[model samples]
Target: MANHELLKLTANQVKKGNYNKAILAIGSCEAHGLHLPEGTDTLVSYKLSCMVADRVDGLLVLPPVTVGYSGHYDTFPFTITLAYDTVIQVIYDILESVLRNGINRIFLMNGHDGNIAPIEIAARKIKEKYPDARIAALPQWWVTAGELLPPDTFEVWNGLGHGGEGETSIVYYLFPEWCEKELATCVVPDHLPDKIEIKWDFAELTNTGNTGDATKATVEKGEKMTKVLVDCVVDAIKKLDAVNWDYSSTNAASKL
Candidate 1:
């Protein structure tokens, strides 16, 4: 198999490969209940990126940004929080580096909610600076996994939550030894109304430092989730490659 990991490849190998696209995994370091490891977010996104890169030709997996903005989850033990502006700058710089390397197409695989806004801002800033640059993202694979899977896949809260069924299950599938499944717990916030967004701190939602029914997570469910998520990303990258990452319509009637 051709090595698609940029970190592992030599400079000569990268030149010979002529890679033009890259995947950047953005993740966070924070508490994920008492069961999952603090590096859960990083591990999931990075692993997913590697998987996608392995299957996609000319796609390189860049080293991940392992820490992200986690101020909302700081109430939990051992949470590393970066300032929002700092996060934006970090992402911006990474994208700039990729552009400098002659790669104009980039895909961001994000593993944490708090990094969403920063990723958006950074991507936009890079686009403004380099109009020819094409950037795509899977900002929330957790939500996408739930949507892609069958309705009956998860048992509670649709497998949504920090260290919840879906997240825990994926970890169980990817890194079972890292997960203390016996210590897994959940506290679904029933008071929070659906369809109405609540800006509650991690503390306000659950004392366990996690929400949703983690006890329902299973290795089987996790395997299904991983397959769907990987397939989703693989399909997207292949389609984007087909179009040369150009979405502009050629129709004369659509011309602005």
Candidate 2:
């Protein structure tokens, strides 16, 4: 059976039950090297949320927030971003509106790295206002695809990077036709001196705007990685629903 998606349901159907948990997928519209599409983050994150919704009962997947805080990629064409404050306000407002409908359990699945700080800030502020509500936000990259996959599965890149091996592999598995593997190449930034903090741009990193060895990506690895990712998300949702502890007495009562 197909999972329930908020955008696909009617108002009457949505109001007929006590569905308290919801998923809000957040991603970005920005450059992803030469082979991957600009919509890579949004596509992968939204799809992953949908997969989780199908497995976990009473979970409704919200339409994804495709545009995120990506000012660092302004040099690239067709990239869009929201101001930090704007993103935070948007998240807070969305959560408030969701609360109005009695859906207090929110899993914020973020696919963009740049939106982490704003999302965390918004989550904290929301908890301060709505103690009973639970909001959890995490970047999908933190899943550690390398560790999840078999030890000998990959040869070049072992971690997630911008349009790198991990991201490219997943994209290929999900939408092979959309992936331009022929153009995929390896490009990483030079090693930096320890403790040398500096502001840098994608242009300064590599000539192709890529940050990892995309040439090593394969569809088989992507499939395995995606399976583990889905399991992780399903486990998170289950754990969130299983919590029975009361947060009524604590200032940090909001459970992610």
lDDT of each: 0.94, 0.81
Write one digit per residue (lDDT tens) for candidate 2, span 1-256.
7647888888887776446789898899988887988988889888888988889888888988888898888777778999999999888888888988888889888888878888888888988999988877556553466777777777764645688888889899987888788999888666745569557777777777667889988898788878988888788778767764233454766678
Q: Estimate candidate 1's alpha-carbon lDDT, on a 0 to 1 scale.
A: 0.94
lDDT of 1 by residue, 97-211 (tens): 9999899999999999999999999999999999999999999999999999999999999999999999999999999989889989978887888799898788988888888
Write down the TM-score of every candidate.
0.97, 0.89
Per-candidate count of clashing residue pairs (backbone under 3 Å) = 0, 0
Task: Kindly state the number of residue pairs that clash in model 2.
Answer: 0
Error in Å for residue 201 of model 1: 1.1
RMSD of 2: 3.8
Worst 10 residues of 2 by lDDT: 244-253
Positional deviation of residue 101's Cα in model 2 after best superposition, in angstroms? 1.1
